[model samples]
Target: MVIGLWLASLLLALLTLLPLWRFEAWWVRGLDFPRLQLAVLAVVIVVLQLLFTDLTQFNQWSMLLISSGCLLFQLWWILPYTPLFSKEVMATAADSTSPCIAILNSNVLGPNRNAQALIDLVKQHQPDILVTLESNSWWQQQLDQLSDSYPHSVKCPLDNLYGMHVYSRLPLHNASLQFLVEEGVPSIHAEAELTDGSRIAVHFLHPAPPSPSENYSSEERDAELLVVASSVKDVTTPVIVAGDLNDVAWSETTRLFRKISGLLDPRIGRGMFNSFHADYPFMRWPLDHIFHSSHFTLQQLQRLPSIGSDHFPMLVRLCYTGRQQPQDGVDPDQDDKQLAQDKMMAQAVAPDQVHRPETQAVP
Candidate 1:
């Protein structure tokens, strides 16, 4: 029993420390996801060790200290999302003419067949703009009813599962689809014309997750995001970036994106807002995101009911009065920026070499 306890403690300690390596591998980057779960597990293991074993040996002492350190480290990363830290985006009074826009970001799993449920959810909320990820032609067809409400749209349907569609009630101009990093993975950039004739830059993204089925490394995803971030880094107009980012709100890459793009996440000091793995309540994380510039103050943020997909939809309402004072998020240091550049370099392929076999087939 003592040997087993020590082994478990060592394993837990390794899991805690593995993310510090700054590797782009999926398994390493994945360690950033479950800090809350890891903290709880570490605490429970420490308590069990204390209750069952006497702390006389050197190994026992090491186990206790390591487990406690793991708990503290996890809390350090997670506590900000709770009420302990003040909200980065402040709430502002909004009226009908506040130039407000409500956005719905959903990742309807490519193979999931519950299209009616998502359509119903869309009708119920009536968001001003809706961005759907992992949406193929079938899901797009099912969502055609939204055209009457959202006249402007951008659709890129694919079966290889990086498909996306953006629907907006507000007028959209200069809308074009670009394959940011990988040829198959597309992102939408456009200008949204609000009721008051003000235009706000909108970028919608759904980067492919780093999984066995997808890319083994997170370099592509990180590059795609940083590319967008770098493009909009110095934009003077109001900017909003929203979609299923396939990343947690507090991750290193996400933080770097915020610093690079000068965008603000409304989730800070709000809640975890875990929207992924909707079927498994215990194994969920916040994958969907809606980030806006300081010009907009948050009006509402919600994680909507599951539409039979791996991720639940996230809805955010922001009132764009003018460019408010920029709020602080995780400000990336020099190392962060360097790491982003490294990831981008690792994933950067020449245009002639850009042909992915999966992307060759007509969708």
Candidate 2:
């Protein structure tokens, strides 16, 4: 009986550590909100080990290993969500009369039949731009009326989870859909012309999640995001990148992407907008994200209501106020770290030169 109890305690401890070791891997595959669960289990396992000390000789040592592992993983995993370590860039000055642009990003599950709920939500919000992921021909047909309102659009209706569609009320300039990670998995890159003539480059992406059904590892996804970040770094125009990144806000790869891209996340002082797994509130994390260049100020950030999809929509309003003056304090090593990430991105893309797909213009 004592041996069985000891084994059970140890097993629980190991189970808790498993999440810590695989948080990034699980998150990239869209299994969001594992961090909090892992933390809770770790504490419970430690208590169990302490209470059952009489059953095992090395109970304290096992508990220490479990505790240390959980804490270390949490620290490493949570760094991206903490804004103190992230750099903030202000948007370039634009005319005060320009309209505030609002974008709604939604990953409507492909198999979900409730298109009316999503259509109603979009109609209610009246966002300037609406991007939907996992949309098929059926989903596209349901939203046909939207084209009349949007005027400018991009549509890639695929049966795979990669299916993407974008609708813009504003003029879409030089819009092109490219596959950054895998063939046919589209990433929409375009420029939205504001009424005041200021152009903001937008990149919409939905990379494959890391899972047994999908890719076995997250290296491809991480490498793809890093590549996109690198592409945005050199652009002088105002930039905004949004989509289902398949990564949590707290992961190391996400932090590195933000640093390399020189983008700002509105969630800094604000709370995490955990957007995925709407069916299970307790098992949700901020998988979808909105990132903009320093040239813009956040006017509003909100998580829209669920519309029969597994993921909820995110609506963000950004105003193109003139770029503020750079603060005097600059981290000497910051640029170096960014440079390293740039190098990694370059290397990752170099090997796949043959696989690069031709960019298709949005009609």
Candidate models: Cα lDDT each: 0.83, 0.72
TM-score of each: 0.92, 0.78
lDDT of 1 by residue, 1-363 (tens): 778788888888899899888787899989989888898899898898898777997878888888888889888888878878889998876443577888889889899999898888888998989899989999889888889999999999999888999999998877778886888988888777888887787888888888788889888888888877766666776888888888887787888899877888888888989998888878888888888878888889999998888899988989986766667765667887777667667777322322121122222
User: Residue pairs in steric clash, candidate 1?
Assistant: none
Clashing residue pairs for model 2: 89-294, 90-294, 90-295, 91-294, 91-295, 91-296, 92-295, 92-323, 93-322, 93-323
Off by over 4 Å in 2: 1-33, 46-69, 72-76, 79-98, 324-363
TM-score of the candidate numbered 1?
Answer: 0.92
Please report the candidate that would top lDDT against the real structure.
1
